[model samples]
Target: MTSLTLAGIRKRFGKVDVIRGVDLRVADGEFVVFVGPSGCGKSTLLRMIAGLEDISEGELRIGDRIVNEVQPAKRGVAMVFQSYALYPHLTVRDNMGFGLKVRGVPPHERRQRVEAAAATLKLDALLQRFPRELSGGQRQRVAIGRAIVGEPDVFLFDEPLSNLDAELRVHMRSEIASLHKRLGNTMIYVTHDQIEAMTLADKIVVLRDGQVEQVGTPRQLYERPGNLFVAQFIGSPKMNILPIEAVAGKLPGQPKTASLVGVRPEDLELTEPGSGFVDARILISEYTGASSLLHVQLPSGQVFLVAHDGEAPPADTSVGLAVEPGRLHFFADSGRRAD
Candidate 1:
């Protein structure tokens, strides 16, 4: 019953506002992620929950207890930092049990908890190794193991995989996902990577400039974004935005107030000119093994991206871009999503 509730949470550094009126709920055993570009206050919000940062306003509840003034150790939350903050002089076993020792847990019980966590993280073979002797991924696992031994009610991860190589990051993502399944603890992870947000989170909170842009599952955000900013932010190649006039009289049942239209690169297909809604000339084609992304320029000088799975056409080739009527996204003049 470690559900969390944050109501109108705010943070301020002197007169500067860093987090503004954020309200969120996290169910027990849920994997929630906070994602945004750098300096968007995602990490700051996480710190507030961890008791490392003071909350300037509103209430924060963890299982019916308000913890605004609670010390971090008493908050029943464990944080796995990005830097793998392990002791230089201590081995893995000692590092994992150091907190318990400080809190006056009996040495035998501390050893039991440390051994249990080490086995869970498959660090038994490296128990005697120092942080310097372990690889980056192994050190990260040790950090996670250290947190696990605390038996926290909530787990917080702050870009734990940002330092790993691409291959190792992918592997760590897998390991973290499996860890969540096995532990079933309420976890909040922060990252700037949308792919990680999509793959890892049960629900995602998208932030921008210290504000939450939207909150939804990955498919919900991708298929029905709340506004212009989210539509472009959640996708890989990003949803392409075009002036509504470009789609004039093309889409059926288009919203009357729509000032812009969005089409995903994968949704636009190549067709013979005059047969499709958009007539454009290919300027560049990028091949990335599975597909080629074609950049095309319209007569109005607007460049649009289209992805093709079959053989890619050469550069300078003229092509028509076709999109299904239902596949189009309309946005109002205020940048909000429109029907």
Candidate 2:
């Protein structure tokens, strides 16, 4: 395993800069995830680390070596791409061992490595099967196995689960997470899926428009976002942003500079009409098994979502909602977090 360092990393295409200066550190054996919307340059940055894309200006170090100019193969890194990228004609065993063969590993050693990786991924039963013969999840496992046989110091995954069905994605996610715990290899994953990032990463680097937005653990990002963008991006059903006046008298010790207040869907609880922090009319109620999501509209015409347990009140029902003062997140007009 190895640590990775990016100091002032940058990538540009003519006049358009795809990756602005970015500095990050990944300690040995850490699972770091890069998450953002499409075209935010997460994948570009990952490719730069893989040496597939040239750094416009910056230093990249894998462990202690200045690897800015090191070739991808020589960087001791293996990449599992968004696509399965498995050779259809090759059997599972052959596909996993292909890299070793190309590097001229003796046939006996290559066989040992292939068998080991297959065993690790539970692909031994399908070693002789072709890519066309396996399910999507199996193919992805083959792709990961291919990288594992390389015994890379760093493993780079570029949205490796986006191709699978929702159920399969969840299963593969567990597989990958278990793999990380068992092998303890240094891993860097890039995905636009925040839920995926939350589940797998020890640290998440949130990016936006080629710039670093926030870097924190899943709980830190969700509970104490550094900015409005991160506040809205990290959670499902998003955060409800309301002008401070909406709950002016309801909160105590609110910063005078705060222009906006953010309340997470799960934090708001429905109460008797006119009895809580604010009053609203329930516009819609969506039952999602354990919890029902209530879409309530304030008198000001703004809608907020509340994740409520128990039976959902009917639509257009008058209700009051309250969130603990500690759970409310305040932001300035500039959208930066405010105390």
State the lDDT at 143 in candidate 2: 97
lDDT of 2 by residue, 275-306 (tens): 88889999999999999999999989999999
Name the weakest run of 10 consecutive residues (lDDT summed) in model 1.
244-253
Please provide, for model 1 over 1-339, each residue's C-alpha lDDT reduced to its tens digit, 9 standing for 90 to 100. 399999999999999999999999999999999999999999999999999999999999998899999999999999999999999999999999999999999999999999999999999999999999999999999999999999999999999999999999999999999999999999999999999999999999999989999999999999999999999999989999999787688777789989999999999999999888879999999998999999999989999989889899999999988989888999999999998
Identify the runs in model 1 with alpha carbons over 4 angstroms from their true place: none
Tell me the lDDT of candidate 2: 0.95
Clashing pairs in 1: none
lDDT of each: 0.94, 0.95
What TM-score does prediction 2 earn?
A: 0.99
lDDT of 1 at 234: 96
Per-prediction TM-score to the true structure, in the order listed: 0.98, 0.99
